[model samples]
Each structure stands twice: as C-alpha cells, then as structure tokens.
Target: MTALPQERRIVTAIPGPKSQELQARRTAAVAQGVGSVLPVFTARAGGGIIEDVDGNRLIDFGSGIAVTSVGASAEAVVRRAAAQLADFTHTCFMVTPYEGYVEVAEALAELTPGDHAKKSALFNSGAEAVENAVKVARAHTKRQAVVVFDHGYHGRTNLTMALTSKNMPYKHGFGPFAPEVYRVPVAYGYRWPTGPQNAGPEAAAQAIDQITKQVGPDNVAAIIIEPLLGEGGFIEPAKGFLPAIRDFAAANGIVFVADEIQSGFCRTGQWFACEDEGIVPDLITTAKGIAGGLPLAAVTGRAEIMDAAHAGGLGGTYGGNPVACAGALGAIETMRDLDLNARAKAIEVTMKARLTAMAEKFEVIGDVRGRGAMIAIELVKDRTTKEPAPEATAALAKACHQEGLLVLTCGTYGNVLRFLPPLVIGEDLLNEGLDIIEQAFARI
Candidate 1:
C-alpha cells in the first residue's frame, strides 16, 4: 500500500552506509541483550518487501517473524487503526472499557476452534497470554503442575521460559523460573528415536507415562503445546499424536492448551494448526499475526473455564488497547475478505514442491517439513546420523541476506531454516525468494 516497489534490489552492500551508521548508533544506544537478526534499518515495508534506509529493497521472507500475514500495512488494517488512533489510543480497558476490545474478543470466539460457548481475555503478548492461560487452568483444575514438551519454545517471560525447553539464549542467565513446570518428549518425527511411523504413539505413551509416574497426572493443571511446534523447528507433530495427548488430558481433567502464537491466524493454512487434526483445545493462546504487527495476544477458551478466574485475577494495564483491537478487527476482516487460508495452502503447495526438489538435490537438507507458509528445512551434515549443520544453516541465511532476501533460522539445535513469507506475497516474489535460497544452497 506504500507504493514501494514489490521487488528485491540490492543497491549497495547488505548493511549499506546508512544502515552501518545506524548499527553503530544502535551499538551505542541499545542494550547489548537486545538482538537483531538483520541490521538494516527499514524506512518502509509492505507486500513482501522491506525498503531499508539505504534504498535497498529486500524481499521479505520472514514477514516480521509471521506477524504481518496480511502484509505490514494492509489497507483495512491501516485505515481502521488510523481511525481508532484519531478516536482514542488507550483507555486502559480495565478502567474504561471500549467496544473495540469486546469486538476483538467476539472475533476470537468465532475464529478460534470449538463451537462450545467460548470467552476470550485479551493481553499484550503471547507470553502473557500463555501465563494467564496457565493461571486459568490452575484455577479451574485446582492443580499445580503444567506439562510442556522437549524443543518447545513458549516465550521470554519467567513462567514461559520454564515452559520453554531451549536453554541457551532464552534461559541461560534467567534463573529461578516459576516452579511446577514439567517437560516431556515431543513427537518430533524426523529426530525421534523410533521411526516416524511409530513416533506418534510412542512419544505420546512416554509423555503420558512421565506425567503419571513422575509428575502425577492428578497434580497436572494443564498440558500446553504448539499444535505445530513454532520456534522448535516448525515441527508438525506426528499424526495421531495430538489427539492421543488431547484424549489423555481430557481423561485426566487437565486442560489442553494450544499455544498457537506462531502457527495460528492462517499461517498454517488453517485458522489454527490444531484444526488440522480437528483437535479443539480447551484453552488456546494466540498473538503474533492477530493485529497486523500491533502487539496483542489472547486466551480464548470454554466459557466455564475462562470464567473460573475471579473478577480481578486476569488483566493488565495495556491489555487489549483499543488501537491494537482495531487493528485485529481489520486483520480478521482482511483475512476473510481475501481468503488467506487458501493463499497459505497455495504457498505450502508451491514451497513444498520446490523445497522437496531441493532436498532431492542437496544432501545437506535432512528434512523438509511444516504446513502452509510456516515451513522449514532442517540442515544436517550426514543424512544417516542427522548431525545438525548449524554452521551451514547460519551461512545459508547470511548468503540469502546478502542476496537481498530476508530469511530466518530457528530450531532447538539452531539448524532449521524457516520460511514464513506473507500469505499475500505474489507468486513471482515467492518464487524469487525460493530462487535466492536455492542459489544460496548451491553456493554453500
């Protein structure tokens, strides 16, 4: 919408003079702990392209880490959000309620899985939504333990960091996380000790056994998971695995929570990834992609469970800011009007075909997995042993960046190259980004 050319063009180097200057200023001004994947300072971004301050137009394959599915500045989102900004910025929702927050909650109820009477409480971030979800589950079930899985990534908050399995960057120095969080094995098909065919049942059995024997199922308040693992390699759980876990949670009266922060809102070809298996979660946490780049998150679930918390138990000062709610409403409107679910499915078909072909050609590509636009390739040194090629993954990402294509790498081992192009990206731009990736592969 910003009239910026929807094509990749490298004017100077990757971090041109202006960007380098900003990077120097950033080093002086910004905190050392705040990490930036790319140092280029953006002037404007829209429709799969980010124009940096130096006039370099880079093809955006990351979509701001999947937050801009309708593009960074969709017409509807910009218009509605602008209108709301003119009207009011924030009323602190708790102090003075607004219609926009209620509208967003209504939208979430309709869009998120489950037909049962549902209610939603909005928050400012995915981590906060997850934290509240755990709180609500504990309030409803009256239990203390929460179960997560290996390689899972929740967020940077203390409770979420404990729920998260990765240790280095997310949890290294942050110590003394919240107690009563338990980790179990996930049905990681590619890296499972047993074969993929048996991975689902075996992993489910082991997790259930762990909960029953070690954590004690009766003490478990909830079992939270990403239907399609997000920062954990974009790994889709093996077939039957989610259903088995869901059934176990139901039997044990443990709330089943789906953290759809990364995999929700049409990124996974479905409104939510859990819908792929028709597994309706008792509580679902959502954020990223909900508000077209605005910070907003939510916990939507069964009415009874959601209502379990006391009146003063669940809200924050900035929760459900009216401007962000307006953006979410606009995003949902755009998603429906444009049919982004179909677009995501098409992206998957296109990307999988090309990536599958690349896997056939390149021995370094150990696995090509994920649904819809949220896909990834796990690089490895050897096919048989699956020794992670983290160095190669980093090299390939850097090469793509130099070629004016923005890509992101993620996974527990840091060897996964994830592709999360905007659902609105044109076929030509999408293929061009893939071409850049293939060329990077060739060079590596």
Candidate 2:
C-alpha cells in the first residue's frame, strides 16, 4: 500500500517547471500574507520524503513545523481518518455531541503531565486552544491581565499576537491588540544579557519582580510560556527556570499555562515538554502533533479551572470534528505503539552529535540547543560578537534545497536552523539530510 518512496531524488531544479508554474498560479490565488518556507508544491509525502509536483523527492528535516511527527501519511492516522470519513466528516460537536471528542479528552487527561484531576476542551487550532486557555484562566481567577515571556510564540490570533514578542512578521501592522498582556524576559541562554550560568534563576527572579511591581500579581490571571520555543526559535529556557516560574505562579495564585503546541506529543522525547522540567502547568494548550497531520487542538488543565468556564462558553462549531478526533486517537496509538518518545530521544542524540561537530568547524553556529527531535543551531556573523547571520542562514537553506533536502530557518532574529524530523524517519535518511546540511554549510 505504500506508494511513495522514501528517498531523495531530484529530477529537475529545486522548484522545477511544474512547481514554478504552480507557484505562479499560487501567487495570484493565495494571499501574500500567508507565507510558505519553500515554493515547491507537494504531490505526495511519506516517511522522510516530500515529493514535489516535478517528481523531485526531498528529505524532510522539518516535520511540517512539528505537525506531522508520526509521518505525513501515517498508516494509523490515514486509516482512522478515512474510516471516519466514510461514515461522517462533520456534524459539529456543539450541535451534535460525539463520543470521539470525549475519547480524545480522556486520552489527553491520561497523557498530559499530571496525575491530578484534569479536563480538556478541544478546539480547531493551536491559537484557539491558547485563547481558550486564557479565557478559562481569567474565568477561574477573575483577573484580566496575563503575563508572557519574550521569545515565546503562542499563536496568531489577536490575543496571541499581543502575547507574542516578534513584531515584524506576526504583528507588524495589525495593532490595537487585546489589552492586559504583559511581557517578561525568558532564560534564553545564548542571548541572555548577563550570561548562561545565571540566566535561569536571574530571569525567574526578574520576571516575578516585574509582575509584582508592574502588573500586580493579584490582578494577573495567568503566566504563559512555551517549554520549548518554536517560531521565536527553538530556545529552551535554561535549567530551573520553568520550575522557578511555576512556583511563583502557584504562590501568587495565578494560573500557569504551558504552550506545548509545537513541543508536545512525543516531539521533545516526552508526551509533553513540561515533563522535561517536572513542571505541571495549571493549563496546557496543545495542537500540531496531536492529530498527526489533521487539524485539532485542546486546552488540558486542572479540573476545577477548566470546569470554571460556563458550559455554553467553550463549545465551537467545528471544534473537535469527529474525523479529526478519530485521527487524534490514531495518532496517539501510533505514538505509543511505535515508542516514538524513545525514537525522538535517539534523534536528539544523533542530531546533537552532528550539529555540535558542525558548530566546532563552523563559526557561523553560535549555539546549538534543544531536546529530543526538536534541535536547532543559532547562526551568528561573529563568534565573539554573537551578531545574528540571517543572510547566511537563508543562503544555507537555499543550498540545502538545491541538493534535495528540505530545511527550515527561524528565530526572532531569523538566524536559527531548526530540525523536526518525523519520528518514523529512517536513520539512513536522517544522516543523509545531515550530510546535505554539512555540504551546504561548506559551500555557503
């Protein structure tokens, strides 16, 4: 049944004639605001390869931005989704409740970082889940203000745009954002003002201090953060930072939320990245890898807090669509049956080993950090100055593309090359992708 071959083969240029023709049509049809990493249109994808319309198969290094962690067309995911489609695609959970939605809620309760009583509300996207998490937190605590960290990416909705730190791309002209969202610094070790050693404790202390003085902790509903940063770069807060902030939130009676949209579902060698720091959030927003390649998201949280939202307030017209729920159930089974967590850890070991060696030879690599399959290297112009090298990063990505490898570049400074390979990706394919990266860096 497997039709797509998992090998890198270039029949033409990176974006061949067919892809270029499609790109021209796309430019006219699709909105310019909606961006894409590569212009090559995918015709088929499986395992570690994405086959473009021009018959070029490129090794995947970015798992659709951590959405397809299992794989592009995972058997379980496709089977369940297809089966569900045969019966029904959408009846709307709000209009007619289904068992699949409840099943997914039960799975989330069992899998997310806490043994404590938990509840979940499904949504259509990571942004919706985040917005709802904040809604529930505000409802529970009766507070309006929310605290967020710098270099943290929550979502693109109005509220999330306010919470996000990057201004140019995500929040350029769209302003007059939702009020009461405050920003604090994160323990970004590489770019920390002071240094890496003191980044953890110092950042936590400063965050708490700022909240108390500037925002007034008693009036704050939640302090939200990403256990592992995504679009703002795959920066993991320095050690002890998350726990410290978690304790502060607990002491102040403010809900703590972990935006695990990009880092959860076995992406970080664990079910959730919050587990990495042993921090159990009051509410955790999840999506991306939750439903394999399908669209589904949820806000899993403490029972009392989640239940505080009114019965009628949380339901959405298409949230937790039955087909998507089925896909999520299948994705969960795939994650467990194949032991993707251990595979992710293995990927971390391999990627870190290769990336660290590359850092030694290439001065452009200023820092290499991340856990499990979510690894990245910060690009810099000068080793001593640590100036961001966005230009070099772009050139390196283009070079890799030409050599039949799909890569992604990110970071607030646009100078980090992130890797999020599918858990089912073959080790041989992984190394081949890395080889392409090494050669590209050499040429760049």
Candidate 3:
C-alpha cells in the first residue's frame, strides 16, 4: 500500500453524509450504552491522522486511547501480524504453545523493571491481565484483600470494576461487585485537601492507616496503582508518594502491582511509568500500546509469585493469540529502532510548554499535568474555586471535532482534555493539533 499524505484535510463536514448514514446504521445496530467520542467512522489510520469514511483526515491526538504509540499501521506491526495471520491464527496457548507467545513473555521479562528473574502470562486485554495479577498475588501471599486508589481505572470486568474507582460509566448499575477489593485515597496533588506539597507523605500515611485499621495488613494481598493516573485526569502522584507506597507494600509483604496498561510501552517517556521514580513493582500489567493496536495484555512479575498459581489456575482460550504476539514483537522492535522513549520525552517537553502557556492565558485550565506524551489539561469554571468545567470541556471537544481535530476528554468529573498522539507523528502535525486545541479553547 502507498503512504497517506500525512496531513489533516477536511473535504466535508466533521461527520459528512457518509459518516452520518453510517452513524444511523450504528445507532440501529449498536447498544445505547456503548459510547463513542466522535460520530465519524474511521476508514484508515496511520502515523498521526485518522481518515474518516467521508474522506476527511483528522489529526489524531488520542492514539486510540494510547494503543497506537507506534502508529495504527506501522510497517513492522502490519508485516508481522499479516505474516502470522497468513501462517495460522490460533492454537490456544493452554492447549498447544507457540514460539510467539513464549517470545512475548521473554521480551516482557527483560523489558519490565528490575533485574530479578521474572515470568509472564499473556491475556486478551488490560483488565484480564490486572485480574490475573491479583490472582497471582493472592495465590503467592495467600491473602484476600486488595487495595486500589481513588479515581483509578482498572477495567470493565466484574472484578476489575470493583478495582476501578469511577462509577458513572464503568460501574453505575453493575452491582454486587467482588468483595475483597478495597479503596483508598490517592496522591492527587490538584485535589488533595492538604495541598500538593504535603500530598505524598500525607496520602501515603492515610492509605496505610486505613489499610491497617480496616483491612488489616496481614489480609492484604496486593496494592495496584497507575503510576500516572490515566482516566483520572492523568494526575501524577506527588513526589515520593509512589516510592513510599511501594516501600510500605514491601515491608508488609503485600505484592505491589503497577497497572501500566495506559502508561507503559514508551507512552510515558519510559518503558513503564513505574520507572519515573526508579520504583520497581512486584508485578506489572500492560496492554494498549504493547501490540501496536492488536489485542494483547500480559501479567509479568517475580517468578516465584507468578508460579504460585496451580498449573490450570490461569489462562484463557485466546490468550496470547499468535497474531497479537507477533504484533507485540513488532511493536517492541519499533519502539527500540525508533527510540520512541526519547520521542515521548520530547513530546512531554513540547506539550507541557504549550499547555503551561495556555494555562497562564486561560483561567479555565485549572491544572496541566502528566508526563511524556500522556498529558492532559483539566478545565475548571474558576481557577480559585476549581469547579470542574464539564460543559466547557464538551464545548471545546466539539469545537475541535468541527475543525477536523480528534481529541479525547477524560476525568472522573469529565473536565479534562487528554492528548496521546502516536510516537511517530511528525512535529508539524503535532503542533497543528496543539494549535487546534488552543483555538478551540479560545472559542470556549
């Protein structure tokens, strides 16, 4: 196939006639609860642009929620996945193991943090990996209680729904969630009542105290967290907070798991977000960008902990699908060859500079926080009051959509604008996306 022009071009309305028609068919067929940010359907996507059915190219700042870090159609990813597709699709790893699955496990062992011997099990999604991580943690420690943080998003499954903090969309009506999971306060610097400077130590102390008194340290099996909170407005925990938490888990023998599904695979300027503070987790769950858009997830951790499960205790029918494994390998190769880690850092610098300036100019931008390419701007009705501006966020997102720029809004309060452009996106397209954001915010 030939290359796309690699520029944003609006030949029709945001949702042109073709897309509008498709949207009608979608409404008739798809469920009402399943939400989509934009009405336009994608025809093709690569690099930083998504070509819609109407033949309009929109600058992609979402990267499919950070799944396409190497771009939607990177050469290596497509080549390997296609080759695997042609060769054979599946022979369930549980029944008949394949080299691709083992290779992915080996790569994850080497790529994740720490020098200790590690092991991994593949799955179909981030939530599955997280649930498995919890399983292994419980099996290893022989404990039942699990700990999670405020505003955290693990997944939509029953057990993961309990692990997740937000409720409106993920867990509003889903009732009778798993029982052993516990919730605690996170070091959300912007919203911490005591102020950001003291958030780290105070929040850590609060969480530990709660766990000790309520759940009891002896019963706690694991503590899972997003080093950089994703759907929770991309809040980076206050300095020392993560290290303190990790140390606490270690001292108590509770397995520490880092949910890097959205923050890993070089999206955070590091191989994993846990590395920002030199923190090492007992286990790490990863997905999204791991396979360059393919569906794959993994639970990697210390060999002993990972091996604690019985022979038949873990795995799924489609876990580590050959094609997805191949895609993951290709994605890893792209990250190494393209040096996407450095690219992510550069993206952080450019975006922070631009967003910080925007915040200075606009009082609605209450906080601009996040590391590397996974950045966000939280909108507020007033900086002093810090009231969430969900309406303004909706308006801004609509404005960008009309202008042919694809952006995503997230946050527990639904007041944040997140940007996650593919690592291979050109500087010009990245800047153009930012320009659209600035202009859209100005209109708002």
Candidate 4:
C-alpha cells in the first residue's frame, strides 16, 4: 500500500468533483446530525498530510486533533493491528481476560510517572477514562466534591460536561449537570483577571483560597486540570502554580488529577505534561493519540487509589479490545524507536524561531506559547490592548485551508491558532506547513 503522501495531486477545486458528489449523497443518505470540520472530504491520509476526495493533498498540522502522533498509517500500528485481526477481534476483557489487554495495562504502569507502585484501567474513549478517574478519586478519598479549572476541557460525557468549562457548543442546552462538580479559575496568565503580563502565584492562590472556603477541603474528591489546557486554548500554567496546587491537594487529602488526553504520548515533548513541573498526580487520565488512532483511554494512578473502585465498576464492553491493545503496543514501540521526543523538541525549536519572526512582523500575532509539537499563536487586535481578534483567526484559517494546509483554531475566545503536527512528520513538510502559516498571516 502507498504511504500517506501517495503524491500530492489537486486535480479539481478544493472539494473537487468526487467530494461534491459525495456531499450531496451524504446529506441525503447519512444522518442529518452528522457534522464535518471542512467542506472537503478525505479519501486517504498518512504522515502529516491528508488527501481529500478531490485528490488535493494538504499538509496536516492538526493531526486529527492531536490523535495520530506517530503518523496516520504508522507502519508498526498497521502491521500489528492486521496481525491481531487475523487472530480474533473481541473477547471482552471483563468476560474473558486477554493477554493483550493486561499487557497494555502493564505497559501503562511502567510508563506513567512515579516509581511507586501503580495500576491502570483502560476504557474506550477519553471521556470514559476521565469518568473512571473520578470514580477512583472518589472511592479513594471518600469525598463528594470534584474541582475543575476554568477554560479546561475534560470530555463530552455528562460528568465530563459538568467538568468542562465552556458553556456553548459543549453545555449550551445540556443542563442539570452532574452534581457536586465545582468550577475554579485556572492560571491563564494571558487572560488572567489580574492582567495579561501579571498572572502568577497571586491568581493561583486566590483560586485555591476560594475552593478551600466554598467547597471545603475535606469534601473535595479530586481537583482535575490539564497540565497544559488542551481544548481551552492550550494555555500552559504559569510557573510555581502546578507545584503549589500539588502541595494543596496533598495537604487537603484530595486526589490530584492531570488530564493529559491531548498532551500525552510524547506530544508535548514529555511522557506527561506534569513532568514539566516535577509534580506527580494522584490520578492521570489519558486518551487521544494513544493506540495510534485506535480507541483506548486509560486511568493510571497510585495502586491503592486505582484499586479503590469496586471490582465490577471499572470495566466496559469494548475496553481494551485485543486489536486496539496490539495497536497500542506497536504505537508505543514505534514512538520509542523513532525517538519522537527528540523530534517533538526539534519541531518546537523550528516553530519558535519562525513564529517569533512572524510575531515581530505581524501586529495581530499577540502571544505564542506552547511546548514541543503542541505550539499555538494567539491573535489579537493590538499588542497594547490585547483584544482577542477572532475575525483574523477565521480569515487566517480560511486562507491556510485554501492554500493546502490543515490548521486548527482554539482558545476560550476562539482567537488562538494551534499546531499539532504528527511527531513523525518530516522536517521538510513541517517547515512547509509553517511557511504556509507565515504566508497566511502575511495575507491577513
């Protein structure tokens, strides 16, 4: 089979002849509720690029929202998955335990931070992993309250929806959310109430104090946060803040949860984003990009805490499917063999240099921040006022899309453009994507 870039061929309009034909059939034959990110339809993808039904091959900077970090159609993942399929598909780990499932859990135990004894439970999606993490925390602490940060995104399930910060799109009509969920302010230095450049320990301290007084430390179960907020603009916390929160959770007998669903698997140049702060969480929830695009989410934590869940309460029908486990095993191996951590770091190096130059050249480029392959640029009206320029963001994204680059925009205000290129992306392709970004910004 030909690998991802089979050869760039944009023979027709962006959506092309075939895609337009499919779109008509899609609206009539497919569910009316089906949604799409772009007007073009994908026919194939691989190694940091996606080919549309129209045959227009575009450099993929989004990576399916940071899911295919090892690259789509990864050699090992494809081979291992096919090998497993030849054996059997489903046995249901809960019904009849499988070696692959146990093996994946064992690998997670060894890979997750902390040399202390640990255990892991696998689920089918990031939301399930997040829900299970809460179950573990609640069972371990015997508490009722769960704390989530402002502008932080956990998942889409009912409980996670309550845990999420955004109101529209995620929680607009979804109401009567799970009870006992509390919202707290995250340390977003850029948009902190204190001031853009002034966010620091003081803001973190203030949020901590409020939670302590209102929620009561004794009643709180877990304080879950994204080490680097993913869906909430990819905003990394200010220094001293994560360490401080760690100390607080420890002192209060509350479990600290790090939601690394979008930042794990060497995506952020580290095994886990929390590693950046030298802080180990009590429970870590991960998914997206794990298992090389296969469905697998995990909750890895201190053994005692993970074991607190009732024996029958921690499983799912499709959790740890054998084929998915095989894919995960291969994905992890591929990541290590490729030395993707070093590659992610190299991407950061190049992006910083080029994007910094763009920042100096463009007045609308307000702030650029992120780690490794997960970098982003915040658009603004002016450097002095710092008003979010969402309009410019839309224009820039449209320009990039029209020019054969796949980019994604995020942030609470929808003004941040994020880059999540696969770790296996070629340096030439990576720079080409960045060049497209520069050109897009220049046009804007």
User: Model 4, 1-444: lDDT tens per residue?
Assistant: 236653345567777778888989899888865576567888778887788877799888998899899988898999999999999999899888889988988988887888889899999999999999999999989998999888999888899999999886788787879999988777888777676455658767877998989999999999998999988898999877888888999999999999999999899898888999898998898888789899988999999999998889889899889999999998899889998888899999999899999999999998889999999999999887889999999899888888888889888899999999989888888888888899887777
Give lDDT tens digits, candidate 3, residues 1-444: 218779999999889999999999999999999999999999999998899998999999999999999999999999999999999999899888899999999999999999999999999999999999999999999999999999999999999999999988899999889999999999999988879999999999999999999999999999999999999889999998999999999999999999999999999999999999999999999999999999999999999999999999999999999999999999999999999999999998899999899998889999988988999999999887889999999999999999999899999999999999999988898899889989987877
Candidate 2 residue 341 C-alpha distance from true site, Å: 0.3
**What value of lDDT does candidate 1 attain over all alpha carbons?**
0.95
TM-score of each: 0.99, 0.99, 0.99, 0.97
lDDT of 2 by residue, 249-310 (tens): 99989999999999999999999999987999999999999998899999999999999988
Give, for candidate 2, the lowest lDDT window spanning 10 residues: 1-10
Residues forming the 10-long window of minimal summed lDDT in candidate 4: 1-10
TM-score of 4: 0.97
Regions of model 1 farther than 4 Å from truth: none
Q: How far is candidate 2 from the true structure (C-alpha RMSD, Å)?
A: 0.9
Better of 2 and 3 by lDDT: 3
Against the true structure, whose lDDT is highest? Answer: 1
Scored against the true structure, residue 216 in model 3 reaches a CA lDDT of 95
Looking at model 1, which ten-residue stretch has the lowest summed lDDT? 1-10
Tens digit per residue, CA lDDT, model 1, 66-163: 99999988988999999999998988988989999999999999999989999999999999999999999999999999999998989999999999
For all candidates in order, the CA lDDT equals 0.95, 0.93, 0.94, 0.87
Displacement of residue 311 (Cα, Å) in model 3 is: 0.2
Candidate 4: segments with Cα more than 4 A from true spot: 6-9, 31-34, 193-198
